[model samples]
Target: MTTGRPPRSPSPSSSPDPFQVKRSSVARLPPSTIATSYPSSGHEASVYAGNRSITPTSTPSLSVSSSTSSDDTVLDESDDHDLHTALTSEQISSTIRNEFGYCANQNYRCVSQHNPEKPVAEDEIEEPPYYILFTTYLSYLLVIVFGHLRDLIGKRFAKSSFTHLMPYDGYAPLNSDFDSFYTRRLKQRIDDCFSQPIASVAGRTILVYDRYSEDFNRTQIYTGTTTRALNVASYNYLGFAQSHGGCADAVEESIKRYGVSTCGTRLEGGTCDLHRIAEALVARFVGTEDALISSMGFATNSTVIPALVSKGCLIISDEHNHASIRTGARQSGAHVRMFKHNDMRSLEVLLREVISQGQPKTHRSWRKILVIVEGLYSMEGTMVNLPKIIELKRKYKFYLFVDEAHSIGALGPHGRGVTDYFNISPSSIDVLMGTFTKSFGAAGGYIAGAKPLIDSLRMRGYCGPYAEGGAPCVLTQIIASMASIMGVSSDLVLPTSTSTPISESSVNEVLMPSVADERPLPSKVPASALPAWLSLPPLLSDGSEAYERIRRLAFNSRYLHAGLKKLGFIIYGHPFSPIVPLLIFNPGKMPMFARMMRKLKPTPVAVVVVAYPATPLVTSRVRFCLSASHTKEDIDVVLRACDELGDLMDLKHGRGERWPIEEIVTRSVELVHSI
Candidate 1:
């Protein structure tokens, strides 16, 4: 079957590097090079330089201190050589921009913190035109009707293929038609749009492999080509997914010293000093008393939640919480209940019902009532009403578990998640769960809470004695990234100014104590919490770069969300959320949207489309995960493509005021702040 439009032609360059992506055709973006100048301080810069040059001995010492300039940090010399060689002569004269895009405009930046004085009124979800909805229903109906007819004929005429789907010789069928219909029929029709392989870093731009389907997507034939596409599909939220950077450099150095695996579980001799150090940094980052790290992000919830509640305990969860949360809740064997997504009233009603009615049948009081919520919903992009939840928690005294998987490093001026965004004390929430995979560009998850609670979970949780500890490199990524966000303690105080790309005033606005006369010191990464051997550049070490990332992500997220709305496309979620979901009400439009966006002119774009099980049948959408690595110009490219395609596909059915795509692109800074 035809995948869509013919794939874009490959780059003219015949360079051997498989992962190098073509630069954008819309406009040439400036290179985003990290500044290498060291800050003048009492600490010697040579110390960090020495640390980066050390070779791993048979037994490495724990107290080694090292450092290096950004110019010298190279993970692979050949990779860099190949990358430069692949570029044209004109491009070779200038710096080859890394995956991280550059934008120095301070006007685009916005503080994500919520001001209680100005409560946010949720934007009403725009409805598509009636004709669009009517046609959408018709499309699904025809597909289902034709699918059943085809299956009937296939079973009657093609018995050999149907044998596994039906009982044969006293053996039960492998799968009934009812069980596999969606996967075998409806989903199979559009399978090519789902998992297209990519060859580059999942940053602002990605190199997507070009392919075509031979047997209705049963098999795909790679054309031995790739199209460089603007990436609005990945979860590299703060854009730490780079091949070259302070974080990457530190990770490479750590691999040399620690040699990857810790060799065992946390409780069975697998634990390293890095584990303890990372946990300490995590606890401090989230403002929790203590924390425990798990090897996998999914297992962090799936395994530990059972230890938190069971049997008579009640688990009140949001209807749209991640599957991992649901899996953990099921394993806990708790009496589970769900409230409407982000509906505080529904939550309150459910809390009252559970508190008043107690356990079902016996009517005995529940052993414990834990309310679980996501800091940001992945599909919908809505944030939990944290302030109101705190209000309910005070009234009902239920323990709260907030999963900050997407929000930890994406939200707030300080990048501290929902609690920071709303200016609520982290201590107010009973449990804080977050993953390193999303923003830190690492491979683990962490659960932070009271020291006693964490200590208890570490010993009793399912992951304690069985799961392998996080790899040393993964831990190094976490430590380096986290420390970058939480700058190292220093006497150098850069004066606050409005002209600065990331101003101290903006940081102060988010980090300001809720109470007057109770000034809290900024949460700086302790020098001792990091591996002594780890070497970071001045910007990463000082936390300036991370602050820029936080602001840039905030800008990109707001820009895309606002720009799409301006172009008259129905969308869902908060303006500040990185995950922007544009509603594709008609099922037929889902694949078309993906195809058009990917095959868009000059620069192809990668996007993720969701339907059915991930969302309601009617509300299929294309999710755009914005990143700090994207510049304003990158967002303009996306907006322009959406505008052109939206016109072609009749997707611009959104109501209210609309702006021309050109105007939206020009006035982006105003639009972001307005939103």
Candidate 2:
């Protein structure tokens, strides 16, 4: 049989016959064989037999090799199966030009166009210089190798010594000597134990773990093998923080439609239909003519307060009003005077003093006097005596600004905040500010009040001109939460008894009653005492889920408070308030107790430890916020753990023992003055 071999050319020379075939004396190879040998320079072209194809794998190297004579050219067989495949002459030429830097126009010639002895001009070069190419590859190599090494080391440290690196005992030293002492110590030693994973939602419970069980599951059952503990450290007062309900659904839908941000200030292009709707709903919910929403809850006060009261005004603020209010008061340049927290008598004293003193040095009557108080004090877990404050405001002719950040969705039968809870008129509040972050399952805040006040804010407030507006998704969440509170079918109507317009004469008459009088001014008016006209039923029926959630929250608060008190723990706040504070007087023991509580058996309870700066240094405490989502069983588990841990750490108070409230307040004042 005749093999398929090409016929030999007539002459060896004669323009060096391009199609000449040469066969070796060795065994004939298959047509699929590909030449393996090539020149050292990148210009070498690949050779294939028959119709086998070659494809370019990467950008061709720019360096060229010296040319070879036709007689000296040789090909070697390659074992690479990919090179054995058939290819057309066009593909071969393209591959040679693309991957081997061969000149296809010169019939796959591997010759350098530029002289090696002379430097090529930048205009003549197609590729980067050799030094530049070398540095680029070096950088990529270093990044890849070092990145992998870093990941490996990080993972090892995180799983091992990282968990125990900074103990709570070391934290006190760091806090005390941050600038002078701790700064020079080992950097890792200064890290706080609770620095990682700031408890955002905490779900139903928080997860706590130590070095031994760092990789434990969040829902791990208590077999004492793992350190994972349940969480109760967050401020999800109504269990709305991490809820996956209508509000969440609305937020998702709004995100799809409006994106993540407005990218503009409220007065520019930031305001949306959802924002307007949310503002209207908030105004109606708070029984106000209008409302203004701010992108940040804190900024609502920091910005609005400055706009409302200026140099000519006087601000009579509660001692324990939120830091946001204090910041706003300072920024306002108003004459500020603080009364003892929740102390109505002290407030009256301040009001009388401020009224008598008038403007400082000027000795002139103040243009305006605004009284700022919170519906619920965050650290103290106490509710403001709104009725008494309103009585005082009416008597003293001062505007009342109530920050209901923690109380809006946490208190009252319908979560209408302190005004509704105390059976006081919402109109009595001059500027009712509340945040959506706590109970409404979203961010941003609102300042709801008379139409003129809101209108004034819209025109003159700094936030309107300078700050970005709330995200559309946030507005959707607010609307969804308000809808849930008011129900779909019913309008939110304030109870007639509380809605009565407050008059100076009426408040005087109410406060005139004495302890010995047959009818003393009611400390808190019960729903039963309301006249028939003022005793309208809630929009949601008693059987409704919304009503039940509020009821369950109230029940959980009482249950947890009583349980902790029974365990000999000194508790703070009204029994009805959802926030419960357990006094841990020893600063050193506060973090220790929190860490130990997280290591409890059966289930761990996650509680937030509040220390100096947030609270009095001598009165550091652990705060537990109850939620409607928590079951009776969940409450019981936490209580049981607290009882056991309290005893173990000797943190339990003596029976009927309490922190002297007056003494603590006095010391706190003194400390503040000294500072």
Candidate 3:
């Protein structure tokens, strides 16, 4: 060999280069959009979608034809998960084996670009990732096993339910013809510990641990022999809702001000000054000229969707739209349509069809073709392509309404939200909606957009608490204080005008355009506290560390993700998200696993189990959360538990064999084909 020569390149040895990626698919995608016609630099795409090759268009391209009535047959054994669409092809498009599961760039070179000759074994390429393989394979396992799994789970619960039918050893059924024993008897029966142990609080050990001390060095109020164990079985998508405490203070203040109730529907007695202030904060947060507040994120979506739509409107919704949107669309009274989730091309096809069909429902109702979307889909924790959606909106002349209930505070820089996350103008989104419970940690919601839209709602359909007596005094203080606390200028209230249209263009230049600044608007006065919508209490954000940590949550989430992934377990959420779901497929194992996690450490954690009613039966998962209070060590403990449980499940399921890549790969591919 030449002295110091770039060590003579290894021959094409017997060991196949893991770095050599082979795209076995019959087709290839262009490096850029198909419409752009930019040639790729020989980088193969493991990323697959049925011809997502082109950029998004205004017309709907995906034909919403049924695959087959037989394939769509409801499994008789499958219980009512309610979320029947969880298993849709639209939701489970990518696999870990498929490209995005491991690396951020699905098209990055596997080996050192400089040394093409020295490649690692193809099997050694950790690029595709193990989790993706696991999930893809698991999904396949679900397809083959969901019905059986559903029956097994149902049978377990069913057998457990019939404790009443069982013959009690002592005093069981009371056939004594005395009706007097009803109330007393009922109380005794209700108190009877007849039920089977649903799950063990301690998987293998009854641990005496303190979660607060272990995780945060703070007080964990729930622990020990007499711990208040609440079944948070419905807690879905990890615990992003409870991770932040700023929401608790905001909720308290809101109650003090708004008086714990909208009192009625927003259109009835519910709309209050409290409601308006809530909407205004949201409007500022989302960068819109107008906004509305509602009881829930679901309502924000359902209400706005139909109000903006009419009989002739055509909607090109992501096939995987959250249930609320689906209900809204179905009830919209407009011509409803759908596209593949995140499929720009499918949306184009639908949009084109609607446009070609042409002529709005008698233009008397301002051509109302509205594009609706959810910020962070609750289950998958996936994101919509906002940039593409905006483009389609502009091109198709459709109004865009984005529900940011899940996107606020958890995504994007400074949590300006999904619009901000995409680096797109918040102005492009015709409507923005969010819930207070997630990022804000409050218990309400708001919608934002142009003043005319709200004005129209107010005149024809508007009704709020103002219709009753007045907004509660406490809500005003909370709004003022919250606005102050959130660092919002006091004059959040826009001038009320029922007679004339609010001039937005003139308003933006003269008044504070975005709600982000600390300076007061021309009309706004300094309030005692910031608005509760900001959710930061006076005592809380005042601390330098509190503010710093609040700002760095996303970084913490990323760190936690890296840690957990290294331990070999699944974590759910979009890229760069604080939310994580430590997924476990077995519904039965959930409660048991939670107890295991709690007992495994010095402090037992009750990781919530998201089951049937929250997610589909096929989507049951254990949601593990990360808190700002968590230190690096805390995350590692959680990660270890996740790994242990995952390993346990894989080992116990079949011949104690590990979940092999070859098996997962072939299974996942087969599942994809069958779908």
Q: Which stretches of candidate 3 lie over 4 Å from their true place?
A: 1-272, 357-367, 459-550, 570-572, 586-592, 611-619, 651-675
Worst 10 residues of 3 by lDDT: 105-114
Select the stronger candidate by lDDT from 1 and 2: 1
lDDT of each: 0.74, 0.56, 0.43
CA RMSD (A), model 2: 36.6
Per-residue alpha-carbon lDDT of candidate 1 for residues 539-656, written as tens digits (9 for 90 to 100): 6777777877888788889999999999999899888899999998888889999988887877778899999998998999999999887777788888998998899888888877
Please give the lDDT score at residue 618 for candidate 2.
51
Index of the highest-lDDT prediction: 1
Better of 2 and 3 by lDDT: 2
Candidates 1 and 3, the one with greater TM-score? 1
- Clashes per candidate, residues 3 or more apart or on different chains: 6, 12, 39
User: TM-score per candidate, in order?
Assistant: 0.82, 0.60, 0.54
